[model samples]
Target: MQQTFFDLEVALASLPRILEGLWLNIQVLVAASIGVLLFALVLATLRALRGPA
Candidate 1:
């Protein structure tokens, strides 16, 4: 039980670093998703307008 408490303490100390990395990854993923969606929307619009021309 004593060793478990020590391990828990170590894990808690490292939690912030782990969460920081995860937050960074999440931000990157969100940005990439938005970029892809915008590109896709533009392509779709262009494709729709192609038949009339």
Candidate 2:
């Protein structure tokens, strides 16, 4: 019973670290997505300006 309680406590304490890692992963993914979107937009704009060669 005592070991179970200790295990539960450790699991709860680790939750925040896990959440923080997940948040960081999400942030990095969002940043990469934004960068790709911007890059594509710029490429499209340049293509439009070139105008049907």
Candidate 3:
């Protein structure tokens, strides 16, 4: 059966306003992952250098 706009609105309204919040969270996580990967590369380079000269 076909649904109506009111049905859609009601379904959406039933959930928390976390859809936008989740989008932001996913964006932050992706950025953090990139940063962590870059930082890990830097750390590996430092480790290759052995003790401080």
Candidate 4:
């Protein structure tokens, strides 16, 4: 008998769950990106004002 480190059967069985997690991660990434962009825009706007920020 031999043991293997990789199993295609097990991976295929969990594909749906894996894809669900991937989607969740993508959502978080997009949200974070928007938040960062908004923050940068605010900073840039303040800098344009030419006063203490």
Sorted by TM-score (best first), the order is 4, 1, 2, 3
lDDT of 3 by residue, 1-53 (tens): 77666696777885566687888899999999999999999999998986967
TM-score against truth, every candidate: 0.74, 0.69, 0.60, 0.79
lDDT of 4 by residue, 1-53 (tens): 75545778877988999999999999999999999999999999987887655
TM-score of 4: 0.79
True-structure lDDT of candidate 1: 0.91
Find the number of clashing residue pairs for candidate 4.
0
**Model 4: lowest-lDDT 10 consecutive positions:** 1-10
- Per-model RMSD to reference: 3.4, 3.6, 5.3, 2.9
Give the Cα lDDT of each candidate. 0.91, 0.91, 0.86, 0.91
Task: Name the lDDT value of residue 45 in candidate 4.
Answer: 95
**CA shift at 46, candidate 1, in angstroms?**
1.3
Q: Lowest summed lDDT over 10 consecutive residues: which window, candidate 2? A: 1-10
Off by over 4 Å in 3: 1-11, 14-16, 50-53
State which candidate, 1 or 3, has the greater lDDT: 1
Off by over 4 Å in 4: 1-4
Q: For candidate 2, lDDT tens digit of each residue in 9-48?
A: 8989899999999999999999999999999999999978
Clashing pairs in 1: none
Better of 2 and 3 by lDDT: 2
